[model samples]
Target: MKKNLWIGGEYQSASSYMELKNPFNLEILAHIGIANQGDVLSAIKAAEDAKDIMTEMPAFERAEILEKVAQYLKDDREECARLIALEAAKPLKAAKSEVDRTIMTYTFAAHEARRIHGETVPMDAAPGGQGRLAFTIREPIGVIAAITPFNFPMNLVAHKVGPAIAAGNSVVLKPASQTPLSAYKIADYFHAAGLPAGALNVITGSGSKIGDILMKDDRIKMITFTGSPEVGRYIRENSGLKRVTLELGSNSALIVDEGVQIANVIPRIVNGAFAYQGQVCISIQRIYVHEKVFEAFVEKFVSETHKLKAGNPLEEDIDISAMITRGDVQRTKDWVEEAIKNGAELKAGGHSEEGIFQPTVLVNVASSEKVSCEEVFAPVVHINSFRHFDDAINLVNDSKYGLQAGIFTNDIHKALQAAKKLHVGGVMINEIPTFRVDQMPYGGVKMSGMGREGIKYAVEEMTELKLISFKTE
Candidate 1:
């Protein structure tokens, strides 16, 4: 495959390159353009210029461009989904779903762009700070440096780019080293749909090198990142005086209440845990089940999990594929072993290495076990049983990562109670923690990260409100 850097509405190539592989079956897919400092600066400059024009562009025109981009994606659905699966190691169904979500998020952002109205502050009604007629109007921050993660490559890019574009900010996108092409595809669509030359740029390379340079660049006004907590912290510490939005790691939780039927819920939960080989940040890493239904749920859950066909992502009926690399398999194996040794019993599918890992489940897992406490991106599920609703809520709250949770109870009172007390970004009733709608506000609490990603809320978080007025003297 011919891969090149997309800078300023065009493709540029360098002699240096990075090799991209299909994690499933370990085949080389293509060589990607590896960007250096010079390329990064040029992309930043282009985006800065785009931001300057974007602010003055009619809001209706901006919204039309966003809508056109969404249409372009929908028109090219099959191509995009296939690329997502091959490059990002996502299963076909989930890969297609990512494309679906990207279309939805972009469309929502398009509609929102036109509605970026400022509310009139009745200065007369407010106390002294008035006469200013301080109506808050949303203004696009200058330029954004968006660094996305491997999992949900297309959707995560949409999460950042959609909001930035909606708020009229120019953006320079850096896809994960492992997953790059899909993002370039997004930039191509925006350009094809008649976006201004400097509106969006895509550059891909080593995170340790290009990531820091992008963050430290003075021209880049905002840095929006989605990755590990360690890297998130590094970006915040180094990106001096710039606005930052970090969607970091999550060892998300799912609570199975005593009321929701166990058999009815396990399939969706298993799909969430094993989908995309469990690479998603919002996947169910820890599951807390009420004591009344704990063992029953486990019985059905394990049986259903065995039926999950695990193999090449390109092949049909394969639920889980090989992880991103053989090293990923090795590390996951080691973590599983550590958890097993630390008194967590392996319930199902613990084999790993050779770039393939079986969907694993561990029960009677200690609260302190690494599998339970840490973010295991593998298809392993840690099950802990609680006798009461309050106890289960407490157990879920104990963890530091709180991206999302699922409460499977029919009782509205209990569900509402759990939702209020869950302390996470989202609460899903009658669903697994993997449930996410493109329009919903998606983010986490505590160490997981800052800010939200779903379209409307993200636009609010991505831009600044500057109230301007003309004196009617």
Candidate 2:
């Protein structure tokens, strides 16, 4: 199949193309057009030109367009899921879930579109002259650049694009090269929904080639990206004064306290650690179990991990699949080897079969090892024992990342304590760090990146606040 870049509301061919393959089987999926510097500039120009049309559009009209896109996606959900599975090698069930979430994201954006209002400020209360009225209104930030990742290509793109459009801002999307087809399809949906030409432009290709163009362009008012901390930092430093919302990497942790139901939490933990081969930014990479329940937790977690079916993602029963690239697979192997070499015990799944790494678990891993300290971004997790609940919280907080963490505890005080002391963006009691709904504010702190990404929060980021004051006679 041949795919062209979606720029200026049309399918335009580029001078070159890159082959997109199914990561699991190496099957060629499509020849995706590679956007060059000129292409990126054209996309930005298109977005800049359409800024006024989008900003001047009424709130209800924007909501209507978003609703139509949601309906269109719902109609073609199955094909969309298949595309995601083929491109990202995500399991069919997980891909379907992503599609559902994408729909929900757009639906939420539609709802938020109509309710994007600012509050009236009390001028008198601020020591202003008595007869003054003050209020604020939100306005689009104009030409936004959305750079999404390979994981959850559709939904992550929706998280950025849906809100940007809903807030009356034009978007220039740069989906991950590994998963650009889904973005193209979404652009098609927006087109069919009667979005104005040039309002949404998709440039597909190498990030190194086109990313700087988007970041440095003064016309683009905001840059919303979801990727690694390295790239996030690069964008932040080089983008000059542009508004940025980065959803970066994380080494999410979970704490399992004593006296909790071990069997009940094991499956959820397995799913959290290994789902999509642990590509999720919030995938649980570390587990600090209370010493009292360490052995039982590890045994049950490994048993559940062993039962996971790993193979072609297109198969409905498959639970895991290949990582996005061969380099990632090798990196995962290296990290696991390094951890084991440092005296960590690999309790289960230390090898790869058919290019797919097994769900790996390690115990006694030192906190300084790469697997434990860094964002593994693979299906490998380390288990450690902590004697006290405070120790577990300290261990979870010791990392440079502050994305999200979870604790399995029946004690309300302990849960609340974890919530207060985890030092992350969010804390989940009796739940995995992977727990996230479409409408909740989701982002990280510290190196995990800045800003929130729920539909409402994202709309707020995509817009600028303007204060208007009037003097009463």
Candidate 3:
């Protein structure tokens, strides 16, 4: 199947190409046409001029268009899911779930559009301002550049695009080369929903090659990026005069306090650690369990992790999908090796036989290990024991990544204490570090990322606040 780039509401082809590999067997599914620098410029030019779609379109009309797009998403569920599994090599279930969430994101944005009204301030309430009237207004920034990641490719795009529409902004989308097709399907929804041409555009290519051009162009008013910290930095450094929001990678940790129910949490913890082959930014990369339950937790966690059936997500019963590429598998294996060399113990599934690395768990891993510090972006984790709740919290806070963390404890005080001290962007008490609400403020701290995603927070970041005050006459 040939995949086409969605440009200015039409399917277009690229001059260059990159192979989309099936992570399970290391075979090419299809070749994605990589966009050239020229294509990048075209997208930017279109976005710069398309501001009328956001600023001129009525709010209710904008909301209606997004609602139609959301309905179209439901109509094309199977097709979109196939594209996701083909590109990102995710399991069918997870891919379907992402599509489902994308649909909701669009619908939610439609509903949120009405909530964007500005408020009028009474001058009588202000000091020395009798007979004066003041007010605040929310308007769309002209052009939004959305840079999404490989994991949750569809849903992340929705998180950016949905908010852009709700806030009355024209958007230029740059989806990950590995998983760009899903975004095209989204563009199709816009087309089917009768959105005006050039309101939203999609360009698929090397982020490094096309990204600099987009960032440097003054047309791109706001950049919402979901990728690695290193690349996020490049965007921020090169983006001279544009507003930017980043959702970079993370090695988020999870703490299990003493007196927690070990059996009750073991299975959930294992799933969180290995879900999506651990490609998720907020997946549990580090686990700090109390010394009392450390040995038992390690054994149970490993045993349950082994229960996961790893294969193609397209398969009927596989528990985990393949890695995105052979290189990803190799890197994950290498990190495990380095962690072991740095005094971490591999309890299960540490070797890489093919593109599919086994679901791995490392115990007694030192703080010095890369598995504890870097974002592995694969199904490998470091599990260690903590002597005290404070120690566990401290260990979890030691990393530069602060995207998300969680604690499992029945005691309300312990949960609250950990929630207050975890030092991450989002903390989940009595759960693993993988929970997120679509409307909540979602971002990271330190190297994890800058700025928040989710629709409301992104809207705040994507817009320039302007307050108008009137002189008393």
Candidate 4:
């Protein structure tokens, strides 16, 4: 199948194309159009042209369009899930969950569209103020550039586009090249829902080729990106004065306190660490277990990891699949080897079979190891023992990336303490760091990125606040 760029409400061919292959079986999925400099500029221009239309669109109309798109996604949920599995190598069941989340995200955006209002200011609060009224309202921030990642392709794109549309902003989307099909599918839904021409455009290709153009263009008012810290930093440095919302990398950690039921939490931790082969930004990579329960937790974790089935993502029974690229697989392998060389004990899995890295667990790993300190976007986790609650908090906060961290504790005081001192965007008291709903204010501090997403917050990011006052004589 051939997939072309969706620009100006039409499918346009490009001069070059790249084959998208299924990572698990190496089957050719589709030939995706590679956007060049001209293509990127054209997409930005299209979005810029549609800005007025989008800005002038009524709140009710935007809500209705988002509702229609949500219904369409629900109707074709299975097909969309299959596309994600093929393109992103996400397991079938996990892909379906992502589709469900995408639907919820759009639904949330639809509801937020009507609620996009500002507050009334007390103009009479000042000493000289009298007989005056003042209020603030939000206006759309012209054209937006949404750059999405390969993991959770549809849902992540929905996180950006759904909210952009909610705020009445035209979007120029550059989906990750490996997973452009899901983005194209979303564009089709928006088009079918009667979005205006040029309101939303999808350009797919290498980031190096088109990313700089999106960042530097004055026509694009905001750039919402989800990927590595390196790219996010480059965008922040170069996107001069344009609104930027970045959801970057994370080395999320989880702390397991003493006296908790180890059996109840082991499964949750295992799933959090290995779901979708651990490509998720909030996937738990570090575990600081209470020294008393360390041995018991490690044993159960390894036993559960052994049961995970590694095979084709299309199969319903499969729990694991191939990494996105051979280079990523090799990098993960090298990291595991290096950790072992540094005196880390390989508890469960330290190797790959047929390109799928096993759900690996390591113990006695130093804080400086790559798998412990860095955002190892793989199914690898390091387990360490912490004697005190403060020590656990410090251990989780040791990383430069502070996206989210979790604490499994029954103690209210300890949970509250971790929540305040974790140095991350979110703290899950009893839940895993991977636990996120569609309606929460989600973003990170430090190297994790800036701004926030999740419908209402994202709408706030995509809009500019304007104040209006009327002085009555």
User: In terms of TM-score, which candidate is stronger, 1 or 4?
Assistant: 4
Question: Residues 1-473, candidate 3, lDDT per residue (tens digit)?
Answer: 67766677677888867887766666687777788888878777766667876688888988898899888878888888877887787888878888888888888788887788668877787578786778988878888889898899889999999989888888889998777777877888887787777778898888888788888888788888999899999998889878888899889888887888898988988878888889999999998888898898888888888899877778756768778878788888888998888777779998766577789888888787778888998998888888877888899899888999988887898888987887788898887778876887898888888898777777777676678988868
What's the CA error at residue 20 for candidate 2, in Å? 0.9
The TM-score values for the models, in the order shown, are 0.96, 0.99, 0.96, 0.99
In angstroms, the error of model 3 at 313 is: 1.5
Per-residue lDDT of candidate 4, residues 232-312 (tens digit) = 999999999999999999999999999999899888899999999999999999999999999999999899888898889
Error of 4 at 341 (Å): 0.4
Candidate 3: TM-score?
Answer: 0.96
lDDT of 1 by residue, 288-309 (tens): 8888888898889999999998
Clashes of each: 0, 0, 1, 0
CA RMSD (A), model 2: 0.8
* Clashing residue pairs in candidate 4 (N, C-alpha, C atoms within 3 angstroms): none
Model 2 alpha-carbon miss at residue 389, Å: 1.2
Instruction: Return the lDDT, model 2, position 243.
Output: 94
Q: Better model by TM-score, 2 or 3?
A: 2
